[model samples]
Target: MGLALFELPAVSYEGNLKEITDQLVILVLDDGRTFNFKRSTNTKFFKNSKALKAAELKPGDRVALVAKLDDRAFLVASTVTFVEMTAERSAEIAAGVRRAQETADAASPVRGWDGPQLKRRALDEPGPIPDPRAGQSPSDDPLIAKAQDAALSFSEALPNFLCEERMQRFSRDSRMIGWKPLDTISAEVIYEDGRESYRNLKINDRPTNKKMEELSGSWSTGEFNTTLRNLFHPASAAVFQSAEYSRLLDLPARVYDFEVRQENSHWNIQVDFQKITPGYKGSVWIEPASGRVLRMEMQAVDLPPEFPMDQVETAVDYAFLPIGAAAVLLPVHAENLGCQRGTDYCNRNVIDFRNYRKYVSDSTVKFDP
Candidate 1:
């Protein structure tokens, strides 16, 4: 007689009960066997309390358990401890994690390297001023080191970044229409007086066009750092922290409590963030290695009567740019809805931008002009 499916172990298993939604639970055994079992069968065999708690699973927790096979899924079987550690033990583990993070933050050279604090000296002032990378080679500057480290870390975290993209809005939908591609188009900001205020933007470069337009109207180039700060802040604050994508995509750093899952070499991350008062839930998907955000979904919960909308959803697919940085192209696909007259006013908007880049554009005013 052939061995029944339940006789085998699950192919692979990770995540807590809440994370797994199907009726059948899957578990991978130590012997490299795969099986699926019905949740009903396992419910009687295993104590309800024996199930692993999501909070108990840390970054590096491994467990081996027997599994029974159901129709097309594997469920956890008996004879194994559900959690490797208790809540108290997990808390201690978390404390260690916190300390490590703190130590790392303290050691970062940028902590004390305030650009505004650096004093400008005369040409003949001193012997050799301290090179930030003094003890090290050209590769030793902390900034370079940090960038390298960030790149590596970002490579690992890229899979979880979720980007909400919307298509560009055009008059025609069924038929195709072509506008000036971002790369081929050059833009010059012209003032009301018909004089060119700013005319130096190359289509290939990544610079803030909105800011450029504003400055063109009133010849002022603001601080570079401040512009980056403003552009990134809204997205950082909107997304959920505990969402899986947040943890996987480490950029914008605010959303970092994500969990990663790999399937057939393709990784999936679930990132969620909440907005209180008028409750809202947001989630997204990220391509780990490439840091390409694939999709974003959101919903409003327990909305107040005064609120016009009850739910929202968005998804974005980034093209061409394999990594998140300047000079990369981003075409956005978005959908939105607002409540009006006891009905939802749904609108779809698509924006395509390429060679849409951001950079520091500054000019020294000699006052001779």
Candidate 2:
């Protein structure tokens, strides 16, 4: 029912409050999952069905919190419902929470690439929105057109590649609690066939939280999903349009943001048999000098009423690096944020990509005469 790629289960987290800060709260659920919600002005708090302030919720209270990632990449409480810890039953549930180091697989890098897949719509056709880039340069510039053409065209066959990733998780909102280090882990991501897989490697010699691992993985992919190729691939069924110019890695980049609002769009998420039409919106930056995507950002909006989570936002950056003999633009970093639509909570992540290499085959076949 949850996003398998991000490792987020569709189920809610119910347990006793473990930690509460002015900016965030942590709940250790009956299962090993830890719920982190970022506090915001819009967050609603409830104590025994009576509305109250977030500061009123105490640690150890029996609580049920819905969660999503906030703008700061922190998962703060959105709406909290709790009953004061009456007896020591909270201790009972606390015992079930596993705080041991969670080692995600070190082999596969991505859970699997789901989208950034576009609708293959005809953006060049006349439409309600005039090409925003029309005034940037004369029709002869062809900066935007060529960039669009580059994104639309897949000329090279992409062989499998391997890269090292450093993922760090933080629990505190810098805007409030300053900085709180949560966990850090490293992994190897491999792109084989068409799907991306992740293999957890080193845990930085630090204990890893099972829940954080899932959150981090989800965050990593969510951010990378917005890259030009991933979103505008030939198989996509999404829409895009020219927008204002945007800066990417300090260079002037043309923008072609996109959105998906219809239920029929493949960008909509589904749980079990139900489709959660949480449409996606984001901007793509292309530097026409070489006609390559330099940056991308995506956010999920207009979620269905039944959706358990609220917000989803991701940002990714691409840099040209010498891969084999060519300087290819590839993902170098990404950030993902999610919130529970039930107005419960939020979570965030920052990922670093490095050490990329083309996959090499070691197998050889001998033919008999």
lDDT winner among the candidates? 2
Q: In candidate 2, which residue ranges exceed 4 Å CA deviation?
A: 1-149, 152-156, 172-175, 204-218, 222-230, 233-239, 268-277, 342-344, 361-369
- Cand. 1 TM to true fold: 0.26
* Model 1 stretches with alpha carbons more than 4 Å out: 1-277, 290-292, 320-332, 357-369
- How far residue 116's Cα lies from its native spot in candidate 2, in Å, is 22
Worst 10 residues of 2 by lDDT: 100-109
- Candidate 1 C-alpha lDDT tens digits along 1-369: 997653565443332332222344344322112234344434432234565443443333444434444554324444323545578966775666566546644553321222111111121122223333233432332333333243334323322122211122222111133322222212332222212244444333444455333321111121111111221232323322332222222232111121111111111111111111222344433344444333333343333222333333333333434433532323333332222213323323333223322222442211110
Models 1 onward score TM values of: 0.26, 0.51
